[model samples]
Target: MDLLVETFFNLAIMREALPLLLRGVLTTLALCAVVIPLGFAGGLVLAVLGTTRSRWKRFLLACWIDFFRAVPPLVLLIFVHSGLPFAGIELTAFAAVAVAFLLNNSAYYAEIVRAGIESIGRGQREAARSTGLTATQTLTWVVLPQAVRNVLPDLLSNTIEVVKLTSIASVVALPELLYAADMARSVTYNASPIVLAAGFYLLLLWPVVRLLSRLEHRIAG
Candidate 1:
C-alpha cells in the first residue's frame, strides 16, 4: 500500500539517515569491544575468588554480584550518571554507562563462570592433585580451561545480551543506534528513521543470534 511505502520504504529519509545510523553502529561496536573484555575479566576474577575456602570473601562478592544483578540496567545507568555526582564523584555520560554495563555484565558473568567451574568433576581435581599440582595450579591450569570451554556458548549468548543492552545507553544521550534514530525522527517528523534503525539492529544482531544457536547446539551435542 502507498501508506506502508510512505511510512517505511521512503528512500529520501533512508538516504538522509544513513550516515547517522552508520556512526551509531561504530559507537556501539566500540562500546561492546571495551565492555566484553573488562566485564568478563572482572567476572572471572570474582568467580575465582568465590572458589576460596574463606567464607567472608565469598559473602562480600556474593553481595556485589546480587546487587548488580537485581538492579535494572536503566536504573543503574541513571544512578551512575546522576547519583555519583552528589558524592563528589563525577563521570562523563559515556563513562557512567560503560561502568554500569560493566557492573551488570560482570555480575552475570560471575555466576556463569562459577556454575561452569562447579560443574567440573571432583575426580578431575583429585587427578590434578595426584599429579603433584597444587590447588592453585590445578584450578588455574586444568579446571579453568575445561570450565571455560564448557561455558563458551553461554558467554557468547551473554555477549549478545550486552549488544542489545547498549541501546539503553541512548537514555543518557550516548548517540547509539536508538539515539541516532530518535534524532532523525525528531528532525524529520517521520517514523521511517526508526524503521531504518530497527532494520540496522536486526541486521547486526540476527547473525550473532544464529551463531549463538549453532554454538548451543554444538555444545549440547
Candidate 2:
C-alpha cells in the first residue's frame, strides 16, 4: 500500500508540480474561451445557412460539416500546426489549436443546433411570418430561442466534450494541463502529477456532469 501510494499519490511531487499544473489549467481555460465562442459562432452561421431552401446550398453545407466531422481532431490539429507551414502559413501553437478546434467543433455544434432548429414546428414559423415578422426576424425571435432551449442539454454535453478534447492540444506542446502534467512526471519520475491532473479535470467537470444529469431528468419528466 505504501509503495502504491508513493508511486501514484506522492504528496510532495504533487505539491511541487502544483504551480505548473495551475498555469496549465489557465491555458486550458483560455483555449476554451477562444475556441468555444469561435466554434459556436461559426456553427450558428452554418446552421442558419442550412435553413435555406436552396438544394445546392444545403448540399454544400452538408459536405462541409461531414468533412470536418469525419476528420479526427488530432490529425487536423497536427496539419494546422505542422502541415500549413509548408504552404507558408505558419501558425503558433495556440492559433493552430484554435483553428483546428474551431473547424472540428463547429461541425458538431452546427449539427446540434440544426437538430434543435428542426424540432420547432413549421406552424410556429408560419404564424410568426403571418404576424408581419420578416423571415429573419421570425427565426431570430421565435425559432432560435425555443430551439436552443430544447437542445440545451445537448449543447452543454458537447461543450463538455470540447473541454475534454482540449487536452489533445498537448500533442502540439501547447503546455495545456495534460502536457504540463506529463512534463512534471518526466522531471520528477513520479506518476503523482498525472493523478493531480486527473483530480483537476474531475473537479472541473464533475459539477457539469451532475448538472447535465439533472437537466436530462427534468427534460425527460
Please name the candidate that would achieve the greatest TM-score relative to the true structure: 2
Candidate 1 lDDT, tens digit per residue, 74-185? 9999999989999998998789988999899999999999989998999999999999999999999899989988898898888888888998999989988889988998
Give the whole-model CA lDDT for all candidates, comma-separated.
0.90, 0.96
Give candidate 2's error at residue 163 in angstroms.
0.2
Task: List pairs with backbone clashes in candidate 2.
Answer: none
Tens-digit lDDT string for candidate 2 (121-209): 99999999999999999999999999989999999999999999999999999999999999999999999999999999999899999
lDDT of predicted model 1: 0.90
Give lDDT: candidate 1, residue 42.
84
What TM-score would every model get versus the actual structure? 0.94, 0.99
